[model samples]
Target: MSYTPVYFSLREFVDPAIFAARGNNCWQLLSPEILRAADWLRGIFGPITVNNSYNGGRYSESGLRRWESTVGAKYSQHKFGRALDLKFRAPVTPQQVYAHILANQADARAHGITTVEDINSTPTWLHIDCRNWADQDVPVMVKVVQP
Candidate 1:
């Protein structure tokens, strides 16, 4: 069988410039760890929609800088393609989503999910990532209540 990519498309995971780079497409640059983490999210949450005109979910280095200026995180996982911010639609509340992930936190290792942060206090999106796994002894699923 061939290596078929799923859970996300090249465009779904990064901005157009990434695709334009061809030889260095963001899809090519994404860590398998992050991709598997995304797949795990889809497995538990049904489906996840990323970038849209409403709120951008994924990013490039530049996009990450823009988000950082707006949100104040200089070393965000998104900057490294190791994180994804998600949009939650009908029948799903951020609380529900976070709870669900927490319920299965033990399985995170199998899916490369090192962290799941609920930044639901503001625009409301789930920030999940698998970055610098060496720093984590186990998956960390926590809700960030903005001040």
Candidate 2:
């Protein structure tokens, strides 16, 4: 089945990367499952702007390194292809967004997400991934290293 590319509002931060990945000015390239999770979040939050999605190959190396140092993983869901970093529109702090994610954490997990982070100890953004696995009721990595 052919999949249609859709833009999730939360993928805005990952620009240049996401756009360059596609020939056209695409926002994100998500699988059906990932799209569904995006849609789910949309329904819960009225409307959200995408922060980043599908980093362009050009930025892959640098982006990967940054994510590894920040998120710490050679193969992040975002790198392997099944995750997104989300944040609210202006006037919305990361903490507020984190609250939203935490509020709906249960429902989000049901859609096959296995990881959700408030983006380091700073709580700058929300990182969510769809691993095609059942909701395990706990984050894959919960070691919060506060700075």
Candidate 3:
């Protein structure tokens, strides 16, 4: 029932319909890296509402497409359970959070943070992921301002 330890619960990550279709076996099947990313994001930004009314974090397969169709890159880390878009409560900006992670990237690495993004469309939430990456040889940092 939480986003850590068992980070990908059906009630949280999977949409109700998706969860019903696939059943519970896959509900808690998120990657450890994804869990670590959630942990890292929590450490940097306190009290994030991942599955609240805001819909700030994890998305089911259908959920991802429903909200992010315009963004393209359908097969994003999110679909593969390697990414999350998180929003902090207050007193935290995307720039500040990004810099915080960048400043302490070595620490952030353990939490599987290979990529950090600030989509200008919604600067409050930071999109973080590692996709198929298995090492930290080169991390990708991008800032996209959707017009």
Candidate 4:
């Protein structure tokens, strides 16, 4: 097994809304694979808009409830430091981002990574995750989700 170093962050918060909503600022950990995946995604997108990444463990209960009503569970990969949700510029669908990720999946897999659709099956964002295990490519959906 590849040794994935544990990364501890001193940042006050990971997700803004979660922080504003929950009134807490703390993080658990993130693996190296997840960091590599995040770096690869940022490089591919080239300063694209981002929705969420590395969430802090501080959110108002009500805010978390509201978030869950839409996105489900305040605790997620974003909080765990192994995932990223990206937003595209105008006229670009989430499916397009997913397709882009899939197109580059070959290279991504080489670094032990994978991507998935946005929550609620909407094509507004794409979620990418990385793990220390450099295994085979995990099957992912590359279809466009229309609103």
What are the candidates' C-alpha RMSDs?
Answer: 4.8, 6.5, 5.2, 7.6
lDDT of 3 at 115: 68
**What tens digits encode model 3's per-residue C-alpha lDDT throughout 1-147?**
335543333345444454455666543555566666676676656765444422553433422222334444655655565666666677876667777777777667766766676455556676676555544355543323232
Displacement of residue 2 (Cα, Å) in model 1 is: 13
lDDT digits (tens) for residues 1-147 of candidate 1: 112247666566664544555534555456677677667667666766765432453433322223334443666666666666765666776567767777776666567666666445534667667666544654454323232
Global fold similarity of model 2 (TM-score): 0.53
* Clash count (model 3, backbone only): 0
lDDT of 4 by residue, 104-144 (tens): 66676655465454445644566565522233333542322
| Candidate lDDT values, in order | 0.58, 0.48, 0.55, 0.46
Clashing pairs in 4: 21-60, 22-59, 22-60, 24-58
Clashes of each: 0, 15, 0, 4
Candidate 3 lDDT at 61 equals: 40
Q: Model 3 segments beyond 4 Å from truth?
A: 1-10, 53-72, 119-122, 138-147
- Model 4 spans with C-alpha error above 4 angstroms: 1-13, 16-28, 51-70, 73-75, 91-93, 118-120, 131-147
Indicate whether candidate 2 or candidate 4 has the larger TM-score: 2
**Cα lDDT, model 3, residue 21:** 57
Q: Candidate 2 lDDT, tens digit per residue, 70-139? A: 4445566565546655455567665675566566665655554555654555465566665544444455
